[model samples]
Target: MFSNPFTPIFGGKPDVFFGRDKILELFELAMFERGSDERLMFITGTRGFGKTALLEQMSIRAMKKRKVIDLGPDDTVEQFITELCGYDEVVKTVSPQANLNILGVGGGVSGGSISKAKHIGREKLQPLLLDFCSKNKQGLLVTIDEIQKVSLEDVSSICNAFQMASRKGYDIMFAAAGLPYSYDKIVQHTGCSYLRRSVHEEIGLFTWDEASDALNEMFSGIKGLQIDQSYLDEINKFSYGHPYIMQLLGYHLILCINENKPKARHTVSEVELKKAEQNTLLAYQHRALKPLLDEFSGQERKYLMKMSECLDSNRLTATSDIAKALGTTQNKLSKVRETLIAHGIIAAPERGKVMFCVPYLADYVKQEAVNSSVISVARQRGV
Candidate 1:
């Protein structure tokens, strides 16, 4: 039996990832080009848009010529420096003659304590990285994922370190991925204001061609299973160019076929495709939409529900109509409107119209609202 190649997991890079050629090109330029301002990059997008995957891929490329440091939301700048200095590979690259432990600590190098290094501020860390780059003749790559969860103070500190290192002509590169709100916050910080000059990339849905090509490639070479062009088109339309949903649809479609006969050659039928589509929607609702909706505040959810109520046949709801439905003026809805737009949950298509950024999201919101109301009624009636 052939394994399913589609992966719906967030940040999970499939065996054959596609549709990011331009971004990867930019990343390569950043990694190799000296004095390139693109060395600092900020990637922002909605959930499941492959921001983390992109970062991971860039890190893989960077590792060929640089010491890559991975940071998380809870990591402070001091911790980052400590980890970098303590990394065995970094230490070996910098000082090849030094005999160090696995962590590059506790050897013949000034007591070799990571705890001692942790207390060093940017003033000390910058020189260390500069020295390493000077010796290894390579740069440093620091990748931070989920930037929105990081604190402004920590962001300031990290950016300061990079800025100081870059000022000394050290080949230091920084890449961060986060939601729009987090990106906005970083841009607004005075200490890291230099990021405003860095390359800002907004990740969006895959193009129709990109999505179709991905599906075709994933379905190719599977034993005894052939998907017709019409079925492929249907899957693409149902995915609506959303990368994660496309993966889900492909995954479920394969499962739908294999459930009947795991090891047999079979032509996929329209009926099987339809069932796969249904299962994909259900999986998306639970795995993606529900959690995304749960992150909204009461007021944000209210705005979404009202917009869902006003959705037209084209799936676009006028901002004024949403305000009217909420019994508020458009001015009063500005905050929620901007918030949703920043979160990539909705887009202002025109001067007066807004739409769910994800296809079928409006329908999901409506269904969720109905389910909530039903549960409320049940609880009130003690059912």
Candidate 2:
């Protein structure tokens, strides 16, 4: 049996881990080539492909050699700027009373004046980043996850700061992680030169070999808890090698197998495994999916109901096919797809093909849409 070494947010190494062989290699390359102009790296994946785990590893590395300014989405531009200044004197010198009108710290503003001032604060912080990195030998690693949440206009300033830091021989590296589409969106929103400064890495599901190796290592120390090859393959098939789900399922299995109950055994059958998977997946849907489903409009709900069926069958429907499925034209489907992608419901990999971002949603949609009982329940409640 394997145990979870992951935090709730999927940070840190799990008790068992696998895959990311090439990613660790890239980190070595980045470390070896530090202080170069090409310091920024964009790591992208869907919501649960272990982006946070990779970031946590990098965070440890950054702490060893430099200072890491970790910024979450809620950090204000003023707060961001204040931290980047590095000098307590500089922050103290900015007279708190001098900018009281523009500063909505205490909150009393409906005008664009305060909003524009906030943008300026973020934009002007670029030079400060360069100065701080130049003055300090510890260097700076700024990692902002879920960067798609930030406005495009604001991303431009952040990118400029990273570029400036790189040019000035400041080992200021910017590593951002977000959904798959964020790379193109960022490039389109920023200029060409700015785009040229960073490298991009796409995180995907783990391979069979990687999953096998991870399971082997995790259970190696435990007696009578070895995994069969067939069972391992089934786990991979069900998880699709998605790291978060892989670890999660592994965690529950270990817990169940280790229990002192009369039925306790180190082995879980295929039937039991499926039950575990379904229960875990449905729990996630109940917690995270219900709220988002409630927010959908009638048209969005109908389109998604159809889309869910397609994804459940592992079918990637093109724009035209999806339109036909929804009884709408390609242009209309395109608009709905964009909205779904933005809301993190459905995903469009390249152009036309679409699938659910969440596997459970795909299954739930199919079940709910096609089942007469579910439809009767929906009608009873007027959903």
lDDT of each: 0.79, 0.64
Local error of candidate 2 at residue 195 (angstroms) = 3.8
Stretches of candidate 1 off by over 4 Å are 87-124, 221-224
Alpha-carbon TM-score of each model against the true structure: 0.88, 0.77
Number of the predicted model whose TM-score against the real structure is largest: 1
What's the lDDT for residue 150 in model 1? 83
Q: Report how far residue 161 has shifted in candidate 2, in Å.
A: 2.2
What is the Å distance of residue 382 in model 1 from its true position? Answer: 1.3
Best by lDDT: 1
Worst 10 residues of 2 by lDDT: 111-120
Model 2: per-residue Cα lDDT over 1-383, one tens digit each: 34434322444455444677676666656765865433567777766677767766676677887887776656534556767663353534444444433333543433333323333256467777776777788777777777777676567777677667666666666677776777778877644257645678777677777876766665564555556778777777776666777766666665555453423236556665666676657655564455557777767877877765555344665666668887769886667677777656676775778876665676666565566577788999999
Please report how far candidate 1 places residue 5 from its true position, in Å.
1.0
Report the lDDT tens digits of candidate 1 across residue range 80-189: 86665665444334343454453334544432333232343444566666666677666788889988888887788777767777787887888999987778778888
